[model samples]
Target chain A: MSADNLTRTQRDDLRTIAAMIVPASDAYKVPGADDPAIQADMLATLGRDTKLVAAALDHLARLAGGPFAELDANRREAVAQEFRKVGGAAAATLVRVVLQCYYRDDRVLRSLGLELRAPFPKGHVLPDGDWSLLDPVKARGGTLRRAP
Target chain B: MKDPVDVLIIGAGASGAAVAWSLAETKMHILCLEQGGWMNPAEYPSTGRDWEAKFYGEWSSSPNVRGRPEDYPINDDNSPIKVVNYNAVGGSTVMYTAHWPRLHPSDFKVKTLDGVADDWPIDYDALTPFFEENDRIMGTSGLSGDPLSPLTHPPMPQQPMGLSGAIVGKAMNKLGWHWWPSDTTVATMDYEGRARCINLGHCTPACAQGAKSSTDITYWPHAIRAGVELRTHCRVREITTDENGMASGVVYYDKDGVEQFQPAHVVIIACNGVGTPRLLLNSKSNRFPNGLANSSGLVGKNLMFHPYAQIYGYVEEPTDSNRAPPTCLWSKEWYDTDLSRGFVRGYGVQFVRGAGPVFEAVVSEQKGILPWGEDHHRVFRKLNGHRLGFSAICEDLPEEHNQVTLDPVLKDSHGIPAPKIDYTISENSRKMMEHALARGREVLETAGATDICINSPIPWGGWHLLGTARMGTDPNRSVVNEWGRAHDVKNLFIVDGSIFVTSGGVNPTSTIQALALYIADQMKQRLANLFD
Candidate 1:
């Protein structure tokens, strides 16, 4: 099952949590993981991590004693802490899924100073360095420990 | 398939390809059986935007992780250092950094100098000519005068080390350490048929640019053209022996999962350290109840791995976004063993370029520094492209306890038993790594990298698989004799890293291919008395 199978309430809880995980930053000039376009992309590509995402949402709601989305920021974070203690592996998977989707985003890649393109055919040209840097090492001149 | 072939080699990997190519000169109906098919460069992950992600999936270095049909799983749960190999026409060379470095002369006489592992029957001086021959064949990119090995230049000029490499080079110079341009197999010039490397950033997983010499592009084509037949998707189950206890042929699962047998006069096993022993051990008979060539009983003993440690830091300057080869310059500064450091053998420091964007993000997430929310972007930015580091390939000594044995439970797709690895880092290796970390941190800090991170002994860094079937004159202690021939089975030859006496502190491909060529020459020279 994918994140697309999640109900509206479950999706809202996930978006709220995702934003908390990686909220928008003004200095970095990057949107949060729960940014509309990124959220849609993440949901579409949550192939194997859908169950874990759903589990995290359900557990966070239970820990918060109400809807995780409706919980205050402090309560939600406290609930997330408790949820992490209980669902450590699942939370990591959730984070990994979000990060993978987030970093793969073209805008995010650009922010990282990388163009979203294949590294073949038109591979980058590395600048050649001055070979004279090795003069000192050549001056010291050593030989192999020849075997008898 | 030839009913009675002249020579049948198992595993069309590193050593197999070299041996096949070298032996093809005689035109004696040479045939190699490869478990994996020919790699299509266009289909390689580098040709797609999701290249780094592919490292975790189908193109993973570990067969246990990749789980491709071509790859037979290795049971490495017991081992700290996981086994990593690509099962294709090129084998692990398909997913190698192409960091080429020849073994020092002292590496051959380990017992005499270090008083640890047994001395190799063949020395570096004997393999020097073959090394030169293989270098030319592999399109080796290097400069001459590096006082480390015997002085001889490679076919092509050194690979262009971008600014990041220069920073590390300047740092090494300041410290008065012995750092030099690495001898790599990546094409720097149009020496052979291949063009210059287009700097595909990452060479591992697969080199889509075809700049790296993976033997698939280097030896396979020439070997095929010279009448050597390579049957792909043929997983050899066991080596079949004749009444005289000679290797007759092999039973293998063909592409269609049909069991087939190919008979041959001479059988060469180049299935690497693990696969080689697995085949021999599985080939049990009434005459040899233990296994084929089990008179010595050291078929899969003395498993050696060059366990690695990565010490990295984020440089302040904008480094190349992995726009060049993975490895640049290398330092043999700590390569010579100093007994005061508590290690017999030392390690080679492989200066590395920064990780790609996806890789950076993944590593950041794993390190727990890239928190969710406001700090995520900030931390990711701090770690991404401005990273530069060094990997120390510590020379793991031979231990009889650390070995590869046929797993009783796990099996491949063809029902062939998988090789289970049981390896541990010795006290000597730990001490060597400790020294390496201190020295590496110094170099990186000198290179203007702050917040230095030391991941000592990176697990899942078992790239070099060696020392399983060791080479020695004694029949009791070793599997293959001096010239790559099995002691018990006359017609059976075990080439590949299995015959390494001592694992050196450098890349073994240069030495591996050289040994392959040397063994092939030995076979050719002693054709009349080969079985003697």
Candidate 2:
């Protein structure tokens, strides 16, 4: 169940679990975690944490008593819920690895309408928020620390 | 390699680089040794997809976790707070949040005002000129005439106070507290060969745009042009002494692991709180068996690490969390003592934009709030831009028992002894944290926040390392004198946060650099009598 050389069934289970964490939706037009790019990136970055990912996927398979990929969407979601409920090192690692990889994907950023480029060279500009709300604090003059 | 230089400084970070820049003006033969090499801004995380990995991977700000060839592992078994620092030419400034708040006038007179920590030998008024000079050199960006500080104008304009800051500011106003734009080392416009900040939001791990004022780009260039020689990957093992017990030079391991003794007429130690003490303590000699310049036995004593308390909440309004630097607004309402709060000293609070999505997910999971399955997206969507956070930077008193000692077993790649930390949160700090958390929650509630999360004593919050080799007027109670000269050795000087008498409730880099410049001035004034 190595991340680099995952068995087909293990890979399928991982994809299914990933999709459950970040499901494909028409509303956002975002690819699910099952997208090949997202899955590959997750597996690549899991490096030392591959075993933890495998254990988490294995936990899902054991709960479902079969390949999690073959289960219905609701059943797969249920199994993920159970895996998360078990709450161990493997479960937490899986959640972190998946979320980290998923959010970093260009497709996810595009789906959220965020600029899909590196943050340097040209950074994002935030519109000024209503700062008049701070009038009261400014009007109170200043609060100084006790004199020495 | 060369003839004995006039001045040899160790560590090319914030303080060391400032010393080099200032002393280079005198046209002295200045040579600085850095344990790590210069970092290329092009290789920063902002240029790649794996930026978040920098926080936990090799580029991590924590030396214990970064584990570079030059970094020595710290033994923090006895302390809950873990040290977070980098060993590079620019040092921790490379990964700092760039929150540049000056110490209040009361901070220098803590002993007289609160009867707590010892007063600094030099007061705020004495350091004001140096602070202004550092501001000009570093290109600090903020509004002028901060009521708490003496400085009138900064070199650059203030960075925008984002939505998170507005919400927090509103909360402070409702609470009738003092809030202001945080003075930071980020440039708003092009200044001093550095580009303006593009608001990449992530100031830590690295700033590819060269907007952040890391000394590698800020002071190193000027120092080098002024004839200061900087040798990277040169880890100083110990400060060697002459037959007369005067400071001589240092025995350091070169990049190729070759041991070499570089002699100098004067030795300046700016290797930070942990590194400075570790080098001195390991430099055991016949004259000073305890440590070099440790006649007062305060070289590694009275270590102060400011304990932190963080409060996070979710707002209903969306925000551009990734559009600005993490910290923007801060309040000093509770920065001074109020005996009614059951604490002698107090803490300052800063408003922070929510972290990136990955960070939010990890924090949510840690807090047991991240829902599983179908509920995940619902909760995540609710958190995304609506999240806001604030941190209470509490002052830490110098406790002799809480100190940095040489680790018996662990050593760096250069075979230099590692530093072992023994620290516990004081009752005063605890009480301050408790009060701060309550105030933070109240502010968030006033700002229309729901589902607030509170985490006290953030484990990885030992950012400002200070008070180890503290400065004082009495040689029996401190390591360095008013001008940062070692009390026990005439030619030895310390110019880092380690010489701080009290840990102020704010970032210490500005003060550290100012003190370094002040010490360099002292050295220049008595160049002929330096070793007398």
Candidate 3:
């Protein structure tokens, strides 16, 4: 699903808010970890209901206060900061449901210059290590178990 | 009712999966049942820091993992026995910190040496070969300096983690402590199509890449591929036996609470130390009034948990403690105690690298510090890198008083009595913790760490649950024999921490896996005579 179909004004407000969370620093100039521009691209490739996206953005905006586009860099940062602080059960629950909507959407990636099929290049830190030390007499072979 | 399969396995967790995999070679038809739904890596818990909050929150690891305010018998208000277990296919193996160290040889013979606890029917030598076998299958990481370990063929494949490892190693050496790379079940390098360890912040919930050697990733899949049928959301309520006193089948309630019976010739109870004993007690039959295979009245007695105390050290400069894979180094020099110091058994001291921001905040808050706000943020930022924690796992002697009694009031969703743990630290245990804290302080001093906070000792909790259905030489004193077979019931077998005769200072996963393999061999040899 796409983020709630933001009005042109609302969309701009969100963009402004997103940029402030991770400002243009000298070391790492992250426009936004989850940018609205990128999210627009993600919305186009949506598989499930598009209405879910609308719900997420609407909730995101409601918590931020006023239209996202009108907010200055400082105001946007304040909004993001407030969410981080007061994000309790309600905010988290809303954000979670909405993110799932956007996550399933594929079109949003192209709009935001992202790759849908790209793997997380870095591997995970797993707990098991080398099995080569085992004795050949009892080296039992089986597929590594995962949560089902 | 139709005849039951030769064996029925329950829980499908680390210990349970190990037992099933070990017994795979046996010709007996094994029916593995689980209380939770099956999971897949593609759909496993996400890699985000916020992922745990999405999955009902109850499954996540907390300082207190009982549940939400009013969800179950366990919650924030009342009980300290925070029962945080997953009710899914692979069970808690899905979310585990895979630190798998074998119990030292002395752990099994504690009673003989220290005059405390009962000596195991079988010693470390008997379980050594099986330990080696499990290391290979589970892909353990370690160096071969310990005399108890068997000679390695190809040796360890991966080196230990980061700067924290070197620092811990140096401190251990300075204190004349025996230090080594932890024998972890984490994939140090790529193995069995899974990727190698990449410094991910999250190891719990589930490994995003199938590197953690969780039983679901390592064994259950293989069991299924090898013609083993795994039924999920099926909870076995009782094991029904025939007039001949042989287990005929299991009576269970399906996920929908519909009563059903699955017949089996033999039954294997590998429901871990807590669940196994609880199940046995619930499975009250006519011949065995106390519980099935519990004629000795020792089925649910002598519960032991390796109580531990965590000590934290905070330094001024940044330490790359949380940058790499979790725990890399450990010291077991003090694992064997010299009772002249006034403590009975010793403790295994190991250092975990660091904690996440949220975890750090929670701990600091629990210390009566502000959890949220500028002060919390500032402290967390400072603790982000330079902080380190050491865990001291002390040996807990088996006491009949510290037992798992059924909560007359509490019941699970399946209408089964929940386990109520009545535990208190023994004086010997308290002394061991105190000694361990002092040793930890010495290590910090050796490392030149000035700001150190030693956490108060607490009751043990986690994957290492042992010593309920203990194995012994005598039929009257133990529930299982030396080979992990029930004394009175020949076909019934138990191979988990429940069969532990003594609680060791080390994590019992590797040791439990080894015992399962050893018992599996015994079952394989005997199957020829019984089945064919």
Top TM-score prediction, candidate number:
1
Q: Candidate 1: deviation at residue B56, Å?
A: 1.2
After best superposition, candidate 2 residue A143: deviation in angstroms? 6.0
Task: Report the candidate with higher DockQ, 1 versus 2.
Answer: 1
Q: Candidate 3's residue-wise lDDT over B324-345, tens digit each? A: 5566666666677687878877
Put down candidate 1 lDDT per residue, B108-209, tens digits, no spaces.
888888788788998888898899888888888988889765565688888887878788889889999888899999888775678788998878777787
TM-score between candidate 3 and the true structure: 0.76
- Candidate order (TM-score): 1, 2, 3
Question: In model 3, what is chain B's TM-score?
Answer: 0.91
- Reference-based TM-score, model 1: 0.95
Error of 3 at B395 (Å): 0.7
Off by over 4 Å in 1: A1-17, A43-71, A79-91
As for lDDT, the candidate ahead, 2 or 3, is: 2
The segments of candidate 3 whose C-alpha lies over 4 angstroms from its true place after superposition are A1-148, B1-3, B43-46, B52-56, B62-84, B147-156, B369-377, B458-460, B528-532
**DockQ comparisons of all candidates to the true complex:** 0.66, 0.45, 0.06
Model 2 residue B329 CA deviation (Å) reads 1.0
Query: Candidate 2 lDDT, tens digit per residue, B83-139?
Result: 989888999889899988888888988888988878888888788888999998988
The local lDDT score (0 to 100) that residue B1 gets in candidate 2 is: 66
lDDT of each: 0.84, 0.84, 0.63
**Which 10 successive residues of model 2 chain B have the least lDDT summed?**
B144-153
Task: Give the DockQ-based CAPRI class for model 2.
Answer: acceptable
